[model samples]
Target: MENYYVFIMMCILLILLPGPDTAIAIKNTISIGKTGGLQTMLGTCCALLIHTSAAVLGLSAIIVKSAILFSIFKYVGAVYLIYLGIKTLWGLRNKEVAVTDERKDEDKYGSKSCFKQGFLTNLLNPKVAVFFLTFLPQFVNPGQDTFLPFLLMGATYTGLTALWFIFYIYLLNQISAFMKRPRTQKVFEGITGIVLIGFGMKLALEKAQH
Candidate 1:
């Protein structure tokens, strides 16, 4: 159907748009390697799946209606983003000093840590819940069974997301040699740090729709 085609196109465009996920993917891939990036991507996709399930079950509807609940998730998400930004910037300072193996191990996020960062970054963001609630239902025909359509669309979105991130991670890896230079890493990390903080502040200021 034409509507389905449009939906797929929209999904593709949205997937390509830059966001915290992209920033983290780029950060992890450059810092830890492709494996880290994939782990982060997996975490994010899992979060997306949960959001989809929540949306289908009408859980997101409750969050939308309650301003208090909305704020709790929003602020938590925003605070976490800001925390990540600050941690990134702090790492820059640590670069100047000699780091022991133990310190290096601590500085370098392990797989589980990276995965958790990706999961929580996505899971805590209420806007994602909002998106699924508001964005996915428009194309469904009225009076039709909604469950199958929702699941299908959600799975499509998730698959598209994974594909896009895989390509993105590969692209980042391709130029990783240049990106790994000391000067370049410092500059890239600083910019991403600021971007994350900016996103967090912006999200904090976001108003919940009635």
Candidate 2:
């Protein structure tokens, strides 16, 4: 029970940590409104669900053991991050913060794009794959006899993630009056672009340890 409590706390803190996923979510929320943010959250949750299942099925361990496979994943993930960073930076020039944009049919396409971005942004991140494989096991009960504990913990984390992002998007939307200002938008977008690029660089330099 104590381990379970610790596990929950650890997951909460990790999920709330500032990172590429959160930045992407914020960017989507501002660009396409709450629908964008919700789609982003959905994509990330789906990615996590897949990673958890992969871990359960021992696929994650297989990736770790094969250096070539791990390297491929790492480079793909790293390149994707850098690509996102560059794309976000490019969008800064055309900044039209949709806090007040007229709703249009085209936004559905944009939302689908956002979903793919979020999905790939999460899915391609090898660190997340490794985290699922390594981190949760640390908090699993030593005497546990069933896979039920992991399933429950993973589901809890995924649900918490959905709730957290929904609340986060709502709060950010409330600040449209402030964030919609041209200067404010520039400053925020500029920072997001830089942070994303930095994460990309970090990922690029990361090494996979077996």
Candidate 3:
């Protein structure tokens, strides 16, 4: 019981942390609109579902355990993160306007593309897989089957994530008009770009712990 409570608290705190996922949400919100943010959120949650299934099936364990596999997954994920960061920074460098009419992005990133964007962004990040593997086990009881507990815990975590991000999206929407200012837009993109690249480098350099 206490373990469950602790797990919930930790999950909430972790979800609140600003990371690549949060960066993606913010960037999408700033770029397109509320619809884009919602689609991104859906794609992100779907990816979490996939990660949970993979972890329950021991696929994440395989990736974590096999040094070669882990390296490949880690590097690919890292490169993707870095690519997004550089692309964002490069756009800013090239004087790309951060906030524009939705029509402009309609062709560049349609509604369907938003889903794919979020899906690929979350799917390629193996750190999320590693996180699910390492974090879920802490709450499992020793006497029971781990698989059941893992499923329930993963569901709980994912649900909490969805809940929090809904509020986050709402808050961003409330401020969208103000944040759309050109200066603020540049600052937002600049900060997100730096953070994404930093996370990429950190993920690339970090050693796996079994």
Candidate 4:
């Protein structure tokens, strides 16, 4: 029970810290509103399930043990993030003023694309897998019943992620009205792009501990 409490606290702290996941969630929220934000949140949660399952099954251990495999995943994640960032920045640079008629059309298209955008954005991110392998084991006691601990940890992480994303959706939705302006949208996209690139660089440079 005590361990569970500690695990919960740790998960909260980790979620509070800014990362690619949080940035992506916030950007999606600002760009497309609550539904889009929720979709991204669900997608991220699905990725977490995959990571947790891999960790529990000890596939994370194999990936962590093989330097080559680890590097491959790391580079793939880095490149994908960088690509997203560059694309966002490019979009910002090319943004044109929307006429009144075009604004309505954009809104229609935006609503429709929100889910797929959110889903693919998170689904393509490989760093999520690396994060699970690197971070989840810290609170785990190998001496304890390993499977139970892993299960508890996975549950804790999923809960924390859900709570955080829900809160983010609520808060961003309130501000989303103001963010509908062209300038606001461009600025948000630019910031998200820069942050994603930073995350990619950090992941690319991280060294594996033997």
Candidate 5:
């Protein structure tokens, strides 16, 4: 029971830590509204499930043990994140006022796009694979059938993540009016871009454990 409590606390803290996931969520919410943010959140949750499944199935262990595989996943995820950051920053140059009604329709991202962004960002991060591979096993008892325990813990973590993001999305929506202002949106976009790139660089630097 004590271990379970500790695990829950740790999961909450980790979820609250700002990363690519949070940056995307905030960006989508401010730029596209609550529905976009919800779509993104759903995508992230689905990615978490995939990671959890991979960890349980021993696939994550294989990736973590192979240095070459780890590096390939790491660099790809890093480059994608960096690309997203650069793209966001570059888009700032094209003033929103210059967007005509037709252009606006063409330029706007749909629900699928937001969800995909969330899914790929979470899915591509090898660190998430490492996390599930390492973090979920500590709570299992010796001689226990590990499969059920691992699934339960993974589900718990996913549930907590979903709950937290829902609350976060709601809070952001409350401030949407002020945050949606042209100047505020630009400033936030700049900040989000830098944060995503920083996370990408950090992920790129991550070393595989022996």
Candidate 6:
């Protein structure tokens, strides 16, 4: 459908724009490697599914209606983003530290931790949920009297997320050798933290659309 293509194009443009999700992906990729980045992406995609379901089921409308509830989530998301930023920035001085020979043990911890981090980072952000609530409906034609369009939109969005993240993973893999340098990794983490905080701040200030 021509409308579907237009919707897809819009989604791609939105994804290409710099945002917390992209910043998180980059940060994870440079610090931990492709697996870490991919894991984070997977978590974000899972969050998207939850958001999509909320939107379709009308739960998001309830959230949007309750200013107190919405504000609570907004602040929580903001705090989490700021916490991540501070943590990353604080680690800047420790950049040159090498992965100890006990890296094998550390690696095990890192794998599970990375996956959780990825999932929680997106999951805890209520702004992302609100965003989908606001964003996805614009393309829907209520007159159609069919759910097929929404299904297509959801599939397209999921595919776009996967594709973009894959591209990020590939690019990060290519530069992973350089990223392994402690100083480089520190800078990368710092940037990621800052970007996430910025996104969080922006979300905190976002007013619910009427």
Pairs that collide, model 2 = none
Candidate 2 vs candidate 6, TM-score winner:
2
Per-residue CA lDDT of candidate 2, range 1-210, in tens?
238877888889999998888988988787677788889988888888887787777787888778888888888887887888788789787656563353464374768877887888888888887887788778766786426665777787888888899999999889977876778767877787888888888987888878
lDDT (CA) per prediction:
0.86, 0.80, 0.82, 0.73, 0.86, 0.73
The reply for model 4, stretches above 4 Å from the true place, is 97-135
The residue-by-residue lDDT of candidate 1 on 1-210, one tens digit each, is 129888999999988889988888887777677777889899999999998898888898899889999999999999999999898888898775765663467456567777888899999999998888888888888787777788888888999999999999898889989987878989998998999899899989999987
* Model 3 RMSD in angstroms: 2.3
State the RMSD for candidate 6. Answer: 2.3
Query: What C-alpha RMSD separates each model from the true structure?
Result: 1.8, 2.7, 2.3, 3.0, 1.9, 2.3
Instruction: Pick the TM-score winner.
Output: 1
The per-prediction tally of clashing pairs is 0, 0, 0, 0, 0, 0
Question: lDDT: which is higher, 1 or 2?
Answer: 1
Off-target runs (Cα >4 Å) in candidate 2 are 96-106, 143-146
Residue-wise C-alpha lDDT for candidate 6, range 60-80, written one tens digit per residue: 777778887788777777777
Candidate 4 local lDDT, 1-210, one digit each (tens) = 236677778788878988777777777787667876777788778767766787789877777777887787778777777877887788676567456654576467754455554455454445555666677667666666567677667777887888989998898888777887888888888999999888888878877654
Clash pairs for candidate 1:
none
Assess candidate 4 and give its lDDT: 0.73
lDDT of 3 at 11: 96
lDDT of candidate 3 over 1-210, digit per residue (tens): 229989999999999988787887887777667787778788888989898999989999998888888888788878888988898788787554443554576546665766776777788777788899889988887667778788888899889988987898889999999877768878998998898899889989978768
What TM-score would each prediction reach against the true structure? 0.94, 0.89, 0.90, 0.84, 0.93, 0.87
